[model samples]
Target: MSLTKITDKAGLHRHLEAAMQLEHATIPPYLNALYSIKPGTNTEAFHILRAVAVEEMLHLTLAGNILNAVGGTPDMTVPGFVPLYPAYLPDGETDFQVDCQAFSRAAIETFLKIERPAQGATPGVDTIHKGRKRAHHNGHKRHGTALRARHVPGNEEEHFYSIGEFYQAIEEGLERLHAEMGDALFSGDPARQIGPEYYYSAGGGLMAVTDLASAKAAIRLISEQGEGVTDNIFDYEGEIAHYYRFEQLLLGRYYQKGDARGRPTGREVAVDWDAVFPIKANARIADFPEGSALRQGAEEFNRAYGDFLSLLTRAFQGEPALFVEAVGGMFQLKELYYQIMRQPLGDGTHAAPTYEIPHG
Candidate 1:
């Protein structure tokens, strides 16, 4: 049982940067399923997806805060920042391909996989380890170029079994670095931290990370809100974990207090699986012909999404105040999404936002 190690500052930077990217990776797919829901339908599913997406944004901000706490710069503008469609999450699973598809049972299943809880490992001690043997379920093709991000940069194949484990490794590394470097490890600029005032999300609230304690808290909150809350169906904040929230849509019932695992005894949750737009799975801009309305809509979406990322870059770098404008920018994307959604692709499926951040 050899474990991956983050032995230096540069390695920590890579891991945190990957953490930010991992958090951001879940957003587009979730949004794809979220916005894909038809008007006046799938109300329960919509709120679940929307809340989880917003929490992912909070998680991203917390990751950036931890990165900045360790004197590392947060850059969302880099190439490979926005992964290709059907991108693999950093959860170390090779079986599931997170796709940009419309709302359906398949999408909910993928969401469940993305937020699946870990079993058998304690948080700080035995969480991070080598990757698992590859599985052949789900019929998802492996993308050779986009390997699972490992703690050791050169060894991209090794990865944590769960995203919580990934962050746990980062937390452990922070403890080690803090012991070695003491105050020097927390030398990052304080001005770069995004405090609670700038972020308000359902799962959790944001906190500024200034030292090892705050840094560890930021990392732990992300895991708990995502998968670390597996010990209980609901987290300390009394909100259901993202995994169970999505599970409600599948089980056709909401989880109630005192409900056992895998069984929710609450009121029924109605899922209109047939009410989605049937957006093309894993859509790319190249799929649409040039000069077509769908093509222009997809291209315009990419440009607007690029500008949103730029706003996020500035907010993460030092201008935390810009997050308000960035939130506004996020809502603005919904219009572009609707524009593409309204344009039929003629294949009985409508266009979806490809999230292909334009490269400059």
Candidate 2:
């Protein structure tokens, strides 16, 4: 469907504009660092960051669809739209910083600021809270999270606290959606939300949602990122096309689809295990000589990562508001992590640290 044209018409034009704009905001820094790297050395970090960056485009498109279905002009060009990242969103604790010089760990910090929930824990007054219906399902999902982070360094086992509570909290929002939309809730034209023509990213995560429930669920699937699927804050429907390019570089094969869904799957998922990552994960720690900037970076990183995880424990219940604190704490630690990761560790490789949810 031409974005300029539409079939069904019932949505907020401004809302869609805002969503897509939000999505587009992330493109630059990711672009600068990904393309600036030396070809084969930083593969892991490159692939991961590039994959994530492309997916952000897809998110922007999806946001556009929601807007277009309701009669909105998808505006990519906005004043200061590409404003440098690490630039604060409406309510970030610290100004998000996205300097092009050092991306390794710093990129993720800017990202966390963008991705981590905003502060203002007070709902309705400071934050808005919708009432609920299907609290149970969300509660069930909130049961636990595989990824737990801390501001204070910790082990994987320690970060496994149940995400069930967060899911439960989100249920209130879902129930609110149903209450507001009623039957139109799950019904939309597949051509309207999901489309195969613009497949982007690794898994071709976009499913061309055609109904309200599918719309929410389709977008929701994106809430989680896996090998094949990922969601970018941009909300573009097809920006992901840029993601698998590095994969294309590594696997020496491009992603294509055999399914009616027009998504990349199965053998299409091939990769060259031998090919080195395009960017540095900085997984090594011995190349640099002792007492260098690199050595200092390593120590700083361990402590910062530790802090990011500790904050995750307080809001494991899905309190988006609490995520505000986690988000803020994450940034502080993120800046520290970035500085440390960028310094060339004596050896140029650092140990990869894993997280375990704390028992709180």
Candidate 3:
């Protein structure tokens, strides 16, 4: 099999748009698990989920900046921008499906798979390995990597072995296109850039991409934060990369400074496995009775989520400060998540945010 490559300016835009979707894709699952945890229990898991979700938002913003830097429009309102639950990621992993579910061992396991690094594959390195096939999970046949840009027109299919390699391809494309097109490559309006002042999250601050160097920095931060390059556990800043942070939950310990890779020798990480509200996996609003309050709550959450994305769309378009309003909307959705999760599904499970962006 030949390695996937980005060969032109339009092709690079498609990949960056896919990167935005890829970053935003992880948020719902993380939020579902984070909100489903009973208020006080699983504090460690709670912190990890919350932090990772916030970082994903940052990643999405950074991708938007890079897209805008390269004269490409970033549109979150595009059809199929929000993925259905239990869907495969744009990162080309066929081993597991990400679902909107509660915080549990199973959810964390999926999170690990989402953030899993491709060993021996660094950014700018070819990731195609010959003759290696993964057994399909849940009896689903491997149909190769799914193209996230099916909703977008005039773009060819692209796939990567991991998120890091995906961003690396974008970075390399930026380099190639910059050399070929010169200043014309970064022809985007500077007004669309979202600086650090407009965003603040626990994971880290945002970077504004203006040139190839800044664009590469933004992509590097997104990839390294998701999965540290090579075999390293910590990112460049000495902070634990997201993969290791999630792994800490599975290993039942925190990673401390000077700890060797794969062996977190810090204090025990406490987890109350039973403290979570067992919401239905891959839940849809249809799961609730049409006239039921649970159904209304799920729909309301989806509507609010849609509105939040709209706010984000405007923020990315020109009004970067709209992020403040979007942050407020997130808190509102948090309350709605709690209201829904508190209601019983009558099957020993509870309701979760369906994340279905209601269309006109």
Alpha-carbon lDDT, every model: 0.79, 0.38, 0.79
lDDT of 3: 0.79
Where model 3 places Cα greater than 4 Å from the true spot, the runs are 1-4, 121-157
Query: What are the runs in model 2 whose C-alpha is more than 4 Å off?
Result: 1-15, 84-86, 90-97, 117-178, 181-194, 200-203, 226-360
- Compose the digit string of candidate 1's lDDT tens values, residues 1-360: 112467788777877887888898898898899899987888888888889998998999899999998999898888778878887775455555688899899998888878877746323434434543333233666542232334344443445657776787888899898899997998899999988788665456789989888888788789888877355778777778888888899999999989987799999998889988889998889888888877987988999998899888999888989988998888889988877876678889888888777878
Model 2: residue 186 alpha-carbon error in angstroms:
9.1
- Top candidate (lDDT): 1
Q: What is the C-alpha lDDT profile of model 3 across 1-360, one tens digit per residue?
A: 112356678777878887888888898889988988899888888888888898998899899999999888898876578888787776555456787888888888888778877646334434543222232323764331233433333433344557776777788888898889887888888888999887765578788888888898888888888885566787778878888899899889999988876689999999888898889988888899989877887888888888888889998889988988888888888899899888888999988888778866
TM-score to native of every candidate shown: 0.90, 0.41, 0.90
Q: Which stretches of model 1 miss by more than 4 angstroms?
A: 1-4, 121-157
CA displacement after TM-score superposition, residue 172 of candidate 3 (Å): 1.0
lDDT of 2 by residue, 55-160 (tens): 6656655655554333344433333333333333211112233333334444444454344322231123223222222222233222111111112222111110
